[model samples]
Target: MRRTDPEGHGPVRFGPPLPADGLPVLPELSAVLAAAAPLGGSEPVGGGPALLEAACAYWARRGLSAGPERVVAAPGAPSLLLALTAALGGDVLVPRPCAAWWAPYARLLGRPVFHVGTPAECGGVPDPYALLETVRRVRDEGGDPRLLVLSVADDPTATVAPPEAVHEAVEAAVGEGLHVVSDETWRDTVHAPHDTVLIGPAEMLPERVTVVTDLAGALLPPGWPAAVARFPEGEIADDLHARVLDVLTALGARVAAPVAAAAGYALTEPEPVTTRVAATVRLHARVAAAAHAAVVPSGALARPPRAGRHLYVDLGPLRTALGAHGVGDAQDLEEFLTARLGLPAPGGHRFGDDLGALRVRLSTGSLLAGTDTELEECLSSPSPVELPYTQRALITVKSVFDDLRDDAQRWEPPR
Candidate 1:
């Protein structure tokens, strides 16, 4: 089949392909396709302000008093975040090992991103004490230090801040006059009771915080591209909304009629889809746990994933062993595994992590193996034995773990 690279080396397959149901063509969306379609020249050039109001009302019912004027809708959260970067008029502070998107967003906004230290428990929100120091240093360097972007229930790390940590972060942001943007995209995917705090930005810093959540993370497909942001009541709310509209209008980032309609339907539906999605989340949790367990003896430590789809493993403990085995860095290890181990993982470097840091984000979504029919069957089953692809994935991953474990050089005693 000539699948190998041009060099004729062994073939490497890093990860699984995106799923069908995970895309936007689900039954719920299909139902709303035409009804939610946006009329041409829809008076509001950017977004339907009325639709923004409805979303705000929806979020308010969920414990956030979102003013419609402060609410904005866009094609996705990343676009809105870039607008925030422009509006805040300063450098953005993001924790290391954040989503791969942040760097591009920051670059697009022409803002320098300060990679801050993450809390021990989470990946996006900075450590409180470290934040205090970093803010001062940033100010000293003449940066505006006006914005903080936190990906709560973070992506790559799969850790959510405990309520107490959230409280601390809010306090720090407020103290610094830093406008906070809490990216709660993965809020709905939380698995454990302690895995999430239902509080929104309005609950934390009613005046200073802006909440932007891309329903794409949960309800919609990745390419579906529709998101809502809540701006708290203030004079700047109207300005921010207008600015958001401006960006959308210029970028032509309006949510597609069919996708938005489908999203609205999913939001209100009292159907089995939510249950189906939750089951998928549970599957991810299981795969993450299994992967963590398998790699534990190999010095790959994962911070018990609480929410979201990926498990972040710190391979630092085995760095020396891998180094001896001629693995150059985390990227090198990712390359080696993709080639030798047939596991595709996004390198830690993609997430603004240290180049040499032995961290890798492994998404278990590959385990959702099967056709749409098979997936539906699996979703319906009490405990579906994973299909062939998933079995291959587990075996391949476990073999990597087994290899590392058997190699005496890889083990490191916990301090």
Candidate 2:
């Protein structure tokens, strides 16, 4: 339990392993890195003009207008979030099941993180009524609730919060005087971008929200850690932006020179980077759907993944079968499923869900690895589900859960 945090080891906590994508770097991106690798120095404390401008352009394309001065870049989202948490001091309220990496940074700042229950429609934003109730309850309990971190396109659950839901949450947080930090890292990875109405919190509360996006979420490889945040324009926001830059400077969290160049290139939406991300998201979406299909018939419950490379499921219905195998809580379920499926099945507790809940998040990347042909087929094929490797992966998920269903039936007592 005392082991280093899986997301940010600096601030130690029990975090689930971040999903690993084994795909090779894109050729165009590789060319960019190869070209930039020879010219070396750290970027400026808050990012150089080129990178900042590139980020501004990226945000503008997403319909949130901002200048280069309002954006800040860090080596990774965790470091950036750590700086943000330090700059804005107060207790944090996160949704019940959020990205596993969000809380440690708050804890690193010695801020208590409270989990508000989320609406059934999505995993990231808190239920509006629950949000209001929790804020008042925390104040009554002597907590200074000031920051609320949320995601529009979430990890684990892979649900994209609807625009109306986002508006309600923003209204509640702003009404409560809490600055919202919207983690829009998955915005570009929506399985159906045109159909899904992705709204950033900054769009809802212009002067009271900060937008953060990790390049690794879609635009760049995970090894090249780069993330950018956009602070809304206003006098108070300007001062807060300065504080964040100072914190970044103090922590020496500047982006590496080559990575900054690559991130800049990726953010500009060149055809190569755009195509690769679209293809990858498509592959993951199909695989996630297959996994969801396999589990549901066996009594496991999951929302259809709308974005990202993972799906969250509740296996509480199969708890009777799992209990027979000494898998009682979330951790036990995690260990059992990871070993059985030969993949990382991070328990729900890793994302702030209750310890007693039998739930886990399964990464599509875990099942997407194989021979070059198989991997290529997965990336480019119209029906990846027809491929042998893809079918085998789904079969494995179905077989395990189907067996559990049988076990549950066997253990049931006569009525």
Please give the clash total of every predicted structure, in order.
3, 0
- Stretches of candidate 1 above 4 Å error? 1-25, 34-46, 194-198, 385-388, 408-415
**TM agreement with the true structure for every prediction:** 0.87, 0.95
lDDT of 1 by residue, 194-288 (tens): 63565555577778888888876677777667788888776776676677677667776677666666656555534645665677666666666
Off by over 4 Å in 2: 1-14
| lDDT (CA) per prediction | 0.68, 0.87
lDDT per residue (tens digit) for residues 1-415 in model 2? 0211233221234566555555678888888888999878889999999999999999888788999889999998998889889999988888988999898788777788888888889989999899999889889878889999999999778999998998999899999999999998888889998788888888878999999999888998889999999999889899889999989999999999999999999999999888888999888888889999999998999999999888999999999999999988888898899889987788888888888889999988887767866687678899987788778878998899999999999999999
How far is 164's C-alpha from truth in model 1 (Å)?
A: 1.1
User: What is every candidate's alpha-carbon RMSD to the true fold?
Assistant: 6.2, 3.1
State the lDDT at 1 in candidate 1.
11
Worst 10 residues of 1 by lDDT: 1-10
